[model samples]
Target: MIRLVIIGSGNVAQHLIQAFQKSLVQVVARHPETLHSLPISCPVVTSMNEIADAEVYVLAVSDHAIAALGHEIPGTGKLVVHTSGATGMHVLPKHHRSGVLYPLQTFTKGKPLDYSTIPFCLEADKKEDYLLLEQLARTVSSAIFSIDEQQRLALHLAAVFVCNFTNHLYQLGADLCAEHGVSFEVLKPLILETAAKVQTLTPTQAQTGPALRGDTATLERHQSMLTQPYPKEIYQLLTQSIIDHVQKL
Candidate 1:
């Protein structure tokens, strides 16, 4: 049985704690409150000093907290890894074997996720440690990737554009709907269909809108109808970008 110690108290840490609980892995966390929402059966402590020695210590803390936490954890040659996508492995303490076990999926506290669909991006300085990470990742997920720091950084950037930015657009759409006294629920089906279409169709192939068709009159009307300056500017910018992109194709 691989004994695992996870540090920090956030969405990623909590989600990881929950996932490992169902596996044969022994999980221990430095911060217990993070697991408050989770019905975890393992040990959870309040301090790093109270943490038990384990085969792997996963630093699931924030990007800024990583280097500081790495300094605090006693390595003793045990495998210590972080669950960061942007931060590189060099930020980890060199006294011990350092690695990365970044789960390439958005995590929400108290929200259940299908672990099998989430990819685990693994990286380690040593070959043995890499294999160990692979074994640990396999416990909860089948989608595993051996992505290095450079590749992970690129992937992280792409995720920001696809996930975070797109979600922001959804929020904007919701707000627009609310302003027009239309229930956001009305857009749910369209949103689902748009997302489902990407499963088999390329984003470019699935594209449909006034901008894609180069309907200048509709685009101008949309820009003019936007009561707010920011939204109107955004609409013009995005519409022009789409038109420019389509022209290249």
Candidate 2:
């Protein structure tokens, strides 16, 4: 088993600790209080100076802090990786064997997830380090892919569109429903069906809306109903995008 030292005590860190409990040797966090809920068996340290000897050091902190944290780690021989999608592996200290082990899924604290289904995007400075990262990733996930920095950035951008943007749209829908004295629960089934359809069918093939169909009357009616400026602008922009996509198809 690859002995691991995970840094940070946030959502990603906590999830990783649970997933790799067998291999975890130590957890390093700036605030010891943040790690109170962590496993008692695993040694927890407040600083990098006290970090245990391990084959891999996983920095599960925010993107802005990755480089600074990487610099604090004592050794250059061990593999040091971050769990960021937007940030590149180049951000880590030059002395260390740097890499990225970004999980392609949104993490919420206390929310349970099946790690097996989460795709792990791996990148490393060396081939040996890449293999080591892959081996470590397989302990939690079966879906692993060796993606370079550029590819990972592109994937992350697409993820923002598909996941983050889609969720914001759902919030907008819920707000509209609440305004009309309707329960957002009524849209749950539709949301589930739409998500399920994309599993087997292309998004363009599964697309069904006034924008896709070029139903001018319905589109105009919907546009007029949106009293808020921001939501109205978003609606128009997305509707036009859909229409343009269909025209190209």
Q: Which candidate is the best by lDDT?
A: 2
lDDT of 1 by residue, 17-53 (tens): 7777654243445556556777777666776666677
Highest TM-score: which candidate?
A: 2
Q: Worst ten-residue run, lDDT, model 1? A: 22-31
Candidate 1 RMSD to the correct structure: 1.8
lDDT of 2: 0.91
| Per-residue lDDT over 135-189 for candidate 2, one digit per residue giving the tens place of the 0 to 100 score | 9999989999999989999999999999999999999999999999999999999
Each prediction's number of clashing residue pairs: 0, 0
lDDT of each: 0.84, 0.91
Runs off by more than 4 Å, candidate 2 = none
User: What is the alpha-carbon lDDT of model 1 when measured against the actual structure?
Assistant: 0.84
Candidate 1 clashes between residue pairs 3 or more apart in a chain or in different chains: none
